[model samples]
Target: MKLFNWPNIRLVLMFSLVVFLFSFTSNRNSQRKVAKSTVIFVGNIDPFINQETVNKLLIENNQDPQSIGKDKLDLNKLEKSLNGHEMIEKSDVFVSIDGILKAVVKQKTPIARVFNNGHSFYIDYEGNTMPLSDNFTARVPLVSGEINKKNKEDLADLFRIIYDDAFLKKNIIGAQIMPNGSLLMFNRNFNYQIDFGRIMNLEHKFKNYKAFFQKAVLDSSLYKYKIIDLRFSQQVVCTK
Candidate 1:
């Protein structure tokens, strides 16, 4: 009986019309063609890979996607390819409703540069090795002389400590491994060497050095010493 009600039928028809219009609009938008593609390197990307490099990578993979159908472009594959780059830590590829293909990438950061034998390369913060870039050289702490691959983690940790302390980072320029497996540190501002010995007791050694340096600075005797030994426990030994 109520199935013929005028108001109910009118409301149902209006709802159906709105639903049909929304579906039509969505389908039309989904089929729109891609107009352009853009690559964005998000973090610390300079001196490594640039926009042109990323664009070339896309072209190589045939994923340039300019003027192509948005629905046909494979964004997942684009991301996968970008992530495969050694310098790229992570990447995200996506397309907007206006058919603009975009990729955002994150770059890896290096903590130390190593010179072993005749080869030179960078060691990332995670202890991973990275190739040097001809465009720019990172001003991180240099590791020369003999380098032991077995102590990679220790080297990484030493760099991290230097990076965290602004005073030490600015003063300490390089390090070397002696024949006895001991370590020696050099400062840019001072002509003397720091006999760091082994990598252990870093916190205690740096503290002793800091205290001794403060005293030496007051007496204008910092440059007079040639070697400041921090190998002993809770003591600093200096030689001229």
Candidate 2:
């Protein structure tokens, strides 16, 4: 049998230690490079969520990747922070390898102006009540009369008619809600009144108005008529 050599065992142990040290040093250098090159991408963020705010929050919360030795920045917390604002509709965030941040934002679009009691609010396309801003003016039809409670569905339906029905939208300047829940439309150009009751079968009613206007008003000199009542189904009454 060959004899076991103590010096040979020591040499082998030393070589293994050297290899481990080299690997550890290489890993440390790779980590350092990654830490030096990191960038952040922030999307759907407004000017309110500026660079200073981001820097302050990150530094205050100790969320900076460089401070924590992280390969990627945690954008979830940043997004949550931005979404806390009432004006922010949506926000997205991104990060690059060089530690730079990019942000993009989408804002809510108002569809109509809603008034209740003495205060006024904007109704967006989605029928959500948006607080009026001093910086921007909403270019939408005004609604008034007995609007005390929230009526998103009714308001949305009215907006749909305004957007889809071309002739009616052009002719109608404003809408009023009666105490008994009937809808009244006023024409600005013609100085006529349209009594649209309770929005039921509105599509059919609007179609009838189109046909009646083309045949009765446009074809003849009936613009002098004061009221065009289409509240009753299958009939249109014009008063001079």
Candidate 3:
């Protein structure tokens, strides 16, 4: 082929460089657009956890996920804040790629009320103390006694045992605490008392009650009895 023209060669090289540079610039701009539009996904957040509260906490500490150079979001702190409320038993928080935050909350369920010395407190099924509400009425067992500061734990334990026992819980109408720290249960039918002491080996004591009631009380014409003692290990004593 004839010797290539220098001017034409220079023009061809310049066109090639221009095309390469344009493509490189376009790719860089595209990449930057994608980076700016990056989103995060968060889930499992309760609706009750206000978005404004989360924003405030995040902004105060410069922990917002959306902010450049901001500290990573502290999941533990967020969860603690949500769970600190008396009404919330459990809570979860989630962050989305699109900078959305989600929160979910589980409310405490009260199963019974403990009346001690005049002040009343609610006990949940899981043996946790729940704040009493005037608007809410629960048809659970009522426990009353000469309760002191030390007696609260014992009362909570008693509630836990009773709630776990299906047979005794169904039959129990209410519970009373004797001066000796013993528990007296009131049944739905017939004015009788069940002496369940301190709730040690509760499952075993409950089983004993079931066996005795099925054999002696259910079949017998004795619908009325004075007291049924389930305090003894593996034995039930009835006083008529």
Candidate 4:
């Protein structure tokens, strides 16, 4: 009986050779030069920043892209650069064993574009203000007027409501914050604007509007009036 078969010996030798080659390649690549960086955008966001910009950021932050050692690189610093970008919400940076550097970036979700105090910016889903991007413009609803700490949450909720509702998203093109903490939405279908006063009891307010809209649409009287008011406690008010 053979203690060790020829097939087993061949398999063992092949494995040893593979391991040796991997080790040799790894050692050689230990003094790795990061190749051109790859930018991966996560999610369905229309990227506010492009791959070229991301690569530029990486190059600038990497200190010396020509440096021959991934270990010598402060990868965290590179990641920080991407994270600090106004349009970027979060990011991950890493180098493959083959010296390919990949940067995964998640862009901030802009729920509404705000025009306040003669300045324009984007308001993210988290209610944080994000700087406008020169590369791309978000198609989210436009919002104008002043905001205070008291009505910010209510306003944020309104933005979310518009974003989440298909009919509202399609119909509401813009919004205005009133002095009395009410919201006014621009109508896309009709010439009239919606005075959606406060977001309190939002569900009922929307239900009232939806019902009224459906009724108005049925009789072809949608264009007869201006301004749909949904603020007076579960009632739909309109004027000609």
Candidate 5:
């Protein structure tokens, strides 16, 4: 029994040494190869953030793959740099087994663009304010006139509801903020305004609007009204 155990232990040690040597040699060869270029994958281009812009950013910072080697590349640092950009919502950088460096970036999506007192910016989906991009302008709902940064979070909630509904999203094109902090929405196809007062009882207001809208459409009176007020409690008032 002692003789058999000694032979088995010797064979196991020899196999482990062979595996370690092979792994070490393969790792050394990988480190010797330098990254030639970066492969970028953008999930949503949205005209704001593009592949060229990301590549240019890396080049400007001297972090481009052309200057990076597998042995010296810091994936965590690269990812952190990309995430620091306001437009980039998230980013991932990784070096493949074939010595290729790849980066996947996702840009933020804005639901509304605001313009007030010559200042312009965007409200992202998460209710965060982002500066307007010089590269491209998103075709989202434009909010102009008296702007209140304090109620932006509430406004973002309203925008989310309108943007989510396919019917409302297609119909509303812009909005105006009244001095009383109420919202006035403009229709794209019709020459009418929706007086969407403060952010209260949103579900009830939207439901009333839908019911009234369906009734108006059935009666062929959609274009006849000039103003639809949904500020009341479970009631829709139209002015012609």
Candidate 6:
């Protein structure tokens, strides 16, 4: 076993050179200024915030993303700021090797827009309320009248239920919570109103409606009723 063989010496020298180059590259990259910022909005839904807005947010603390050096960039802190935004559901910030400050942002998906007391806001899929965006409006269900904590929770349940069921999602466009605590749904294609009664036994009520809709479609009688009631356990009460 040779202590200082040519192969061993060569290997050590090579390792040293590699480390030196890595250190040099790292040092160079650390000082590299971010050229610009690119925002990527995840998901198929329309973005609530635009690229300009995102770039502005990246520098909201008066730190310019384009001029800020990589070493000076606080990615974690920046991400926290982004996540704290009311419209943002999740966010990730990182600088690319080429000096591009890239941000991946996902906005809260609104399931319904609530209107009450002359105020309007959005209710997301996570049951969180978000302010309406000026950039885009989601074509989700419109929930008007008698909005409260309990009512919002029930509406969230209905939203999830509708979203899960394609038929309900496509047909039911909006809902109304009456002052008497009864819930009503508006059909997209029909002029009649649906009386859901209460939030209890939601699965049963929807099932009954589905059965009635199928029968009505078969008979071409859906338009004959002014009100479709699903309050009872076993039947659809229709008013013509």
RMSD of each: 2.6, 8.3, 9.9, 3.2, 2.4, 1.6
> Which sections of candidate 1 miss by over 4 Å?
1-18, 146-149
1-240 per-residue lDDT for model 3 (tens digits): 545788889988999999999998665543331111121124322242344443443332553444432124566776787577664577676554434555555656666677877788777756677777544566668888775667766666666666667766677779888888878888887677898887467668878877887887657634657898888895788888
Give Cα-based local distance difference scores for all models. Answer: 0.81, 0.64, 0.65, 0.83, 0.80, 0.88
Show the colliding residue pairs in model 6.
Answer: none
Candidate 2 lDDT, tens digit per residue, 1-240?
A: 444588778888999999999999766644542233222334322232334444454431764545543334556876676555454566675544454454444555566687769988866666677777655675567888765445557767777677566776676667888888888777766767888888677777788788888887656655778788878888988878
lDDT of 5 by residue, 1-240 (tens): 576698899998999999999999888865655555464556557768767767665552565666655777767877887788889888887777777667788888788899999999988888888788888888789998765677877888887887788987887789998888888989888787999898777778878887888788887798888999999985799999
Poorest stretch of ten by lDDT in candidate 6: 43-52
**lDDT computed for candidate 6:** 0.88
Residue 136 displacement in candidate 3 (angstroms): 3.2
- Which scores higher on TM-score, 1 or 6? 6
Question: What 10-residue stretch in candidate 3 is worst by lDDT?
Answer: 32-41
Best-fitting candidate, scored by TM-score: 6
Write the residue-wise lDDT of candidate 6 on 29-104 in tens digits. 9999988889999964587878887777789469687887899999998898889888999999999999998999
lDDT rank order: 6, 4, 1, 5, 3, 2
What is candidate 4's lDDT per residue for 86-196, written digit by digit as tens? Answer: 888899998887787888999988888989999999888877788998878888899889876877777778788878899887877899888877788887878998888
Query: What is the C-alpha RMSD, rounded to one decimal, of candidate 3?
Result: 9.9
Model 3, residue 10: C-alpha shift (Å) = 27
TM-score of every candidate relative to the true structure: 0.86, 0.63, 0.62, 0.83, 0.88, 0.93
Per-residue lDDT of candidate 1, residues 20-48 (tens digit):
99999888877888777788777676668
Question: Lowest-lDDT window of 10 residues in candidate 1?
Answer: 55-64
Q: What total of clashing residue pairs does each candidate reach? A: 0, 25, 15, 0, 0, 0
